[model samples]
Target: MKTMIVIPARLASSRLSEKLLLRAAGKSILQHTYEAAKRAAITDSIIVAADDPRIVAEVDSFGGEARLTSVDCQSGTDRLAEIALMHSDVDLFVNVQGDEPEISPATIDAVARLLATRPDADIATAAFPILDESKLHDPACVKVVMGANDRAILFSRASVPHVRDGITPAHLQASPPIFWQHIGLYAYRRDFLLWFATQPAGRLEQLEKLEQLRAIEAGKTIVVTAIESSPPGIDTLEDFREFVARIENQ
Candidate 1:
């Protein structure tokens, strides 16, 4: 199947304020994310599905392909849907958010491979085992509950796979974890991408503010693969500062 990675970039962000355009180590965050996505060995096609001409210009500055999508698109997936319509030849489209400059190419490849390998799954995503007790309960850390054989049962901001009894450190150290922190990276089949765009907002999705839940509520099978934890996306000035510090230190 032909696979391509599409990054949805918008100039306006509530949290960080045009954070994708923010420069770190002399490169914009979107450019860093685009560069990282290009590192995946399985595929070479990559483009930014930008919401503004400014983002398109930025992509052009780096010789990266970009298409201006509607700013009114409901979500990043919706932005990808616009690109999907333009590229009917692509069988698989990977949605990599622009803010995720630290997104792992291995993780991107793994998610794409999972969808390719599993005929029953409609989508594939990555998650990391949550080993820290603090992170497990930190409502900010979204959790993934696995179902039968790689299927995801649910995604939640609250702690899940509810260990009814008191927990211990032993549980955290298991070969396979009982809890996993959901990663934002995703791979979607062409049909699934179009179908997702048509679906209405789901109740669970509305409550959790997680778009993946819309697919879950629609009964679409989603598979989750384990990957190394990637550094969190840039969300605030502090996150950008941390990224700058890491790059300068290196």
Candidate 2:
């Protein structure tokens, strides 16, 4: 199957303004993410689906491929759906959030593999167990509850599978894990992308502000693959600082 990775980026970041364009270690964050996605062997190509000319120019500066999508596009998934229309031959499109410069190539490949191997699933994503009680409680940390055989039952900002009886924290870290943190990385079939773009947001989706719910409400099967951990993506000044430290230290 032909597979391609698309990185959606724009310059209108509210927090850590222009976070994708922010330079760290002499390279823009978008460039770093592009390079990281290129490391994956499963993808036939990597393209930045940018929304602005400045973003397109930045990709050009780094000698990376980029295509400008309409500014009207609402989300990263919409950007990928735009590309899906252009590449009808491509069977799968992986949405690598441009902010995820430290994203793991193995995790990227794992999500694609999950979709390819599971005939019941139309989409696939990655998640890792959250052992920290604070993280479990943090609304910023999205969680996924798995059903039988790696199928995701639901995704939420709340700490799910609530230990109603209040068991020790150790129980949360059980091999299967009671609390699994959802990762933003995703892989979608070409047909699924088309369908997703046309569907309106579901009630739960609007409430949680999680776009993935639109699929769940549509009765689409989504498979989740377990990964070691999520990559630290920049969202605020502090996040950028930590990313800078990692680069300089490396």
Candidate 3:
């Protein structure tokens, strides 16, 4: 199956402005993400869908492929749809976050392969077991509840399966966790991407402010592949510094 990895980068980030262009290790964050995507054997091609000319120029300077998308594109998925219009040959499209410079190539390949193998599923995503109790309650950390056969049943900001009978937080943290943290990486069929762009904002999606819920509300099947811990994404200056320190130490 032909798969294309698209990294949607925007300059005006609320937390850390221009985080994607921030220098990390020896390369810009976007460049690092692009190079990592190139290492994935499952992807047929890699493209950076940028909203600003500055990002476009940066990608060009680094000798990486990039396409200028509309700044008005509502979300990354919308940007992916814009990129999809130019490439008709792509069968599967993987959405790789531009800020995640340390994203694993193996995780990218796994998500793409999951969608390629599961014809019934419109989308495929990755998740990792949540070992920390603090992360479970953090709304910023999205959670996923999986159904039979690794199919995603729901995605929410609140802790799922709220253990009934007044179970203490201590009990929740004990051995064998019950929840999974939703990883941002996703892969979707070309047709599904197009269809998703036309659908209006779903009720549950708007309430939770999670775009992935639009798919779940529409009764689409999203298969999940559990992966090891996902690397930290660049959301603030501190996050970028931490990434640099970790990479340099390694």
Candidate 4:
């Protein structure tokens, strides 16, 4: 399958203002993410789908390919859809968020490979087992409920597969994890991207603020790839400071 990685770079971040342009270790977050994507074993065809000219310039500063997408795009998936329209020859388009500077190449390969192997699935995404009860309850940590054959049943900000009787260590330690934290990474079949762009956000999606639920509500098959763990993306000033500290220590 012909695969391409697309980093959706948006200038207006709500949580942290212009977070992608924020520098750490002498490189902007977008540049770091692009460089990480380059290290992935998948096809080297990568592009930054930017909503601002400054973002395009930043990508160019680092010698990375970028195209200015419309600011009217509601979500990163929408941005990817615009790119899909232009690159019809690409079979699979991977959505690598521009904020994820520490995203693993193995995770990218895993998600892309899952989509390539599962013809029934319209999308493939990564998730890690959530062992901490606090994190499971935290709305900030999106949870992925998995159904049979590694298919995602639902995604939500609320705790799912709810321990009706009350939580237990055994449940958390089950062979097949009882809880999974959804990673932002996604791999979409070209058709899926085009289809997603045409549809309106689902009721559940609007409620939970999870874009993936829009697909699930539409009866789309989404496969989940289990990874051991993934580094958190930069969201707050504290997260950025921690990222910088990690880089300095390294």
Per-candidate total of colliding backbone pairs: 0, 0, 0, 0
Best model per lDDT: 4
lDDT of 3 by residue, 1-250 (tens): 8899999989889999888888867799999889988899898889999999999999999999889998679999999999988889999999999998889999999999999999999999999888777887899999998888889999999988676765466665655556889989999999899999888999999999999999999999999998868988888889988999988898
1 versus 4: better lDDT goes to: 4
lDDT of candidate 3 vs native?
0.90
Q: Which stretches of candidate 2 lie over 4 Å from their true place?
A: none
Per-residue alpha-carbon lDDT of candidate 4 for residues 92-125, written as tens digits (9 for 90 to 100): 9999999999999999999999999999999999
Q: Against the hidden reference, what TM-scores do the models get?
A: 0.97, 0.98, 0.95, 0.98
Better structure of 2 and 3 per TM-score: 2
- Colliding residue pairs in candidate 2: none
**TM-score ranking, best first:** 4, 2, 1, 3
lDDT of 1 at 91: 88
Q: How much is the lDDT of residue 21 in candidate 1?
A: 92
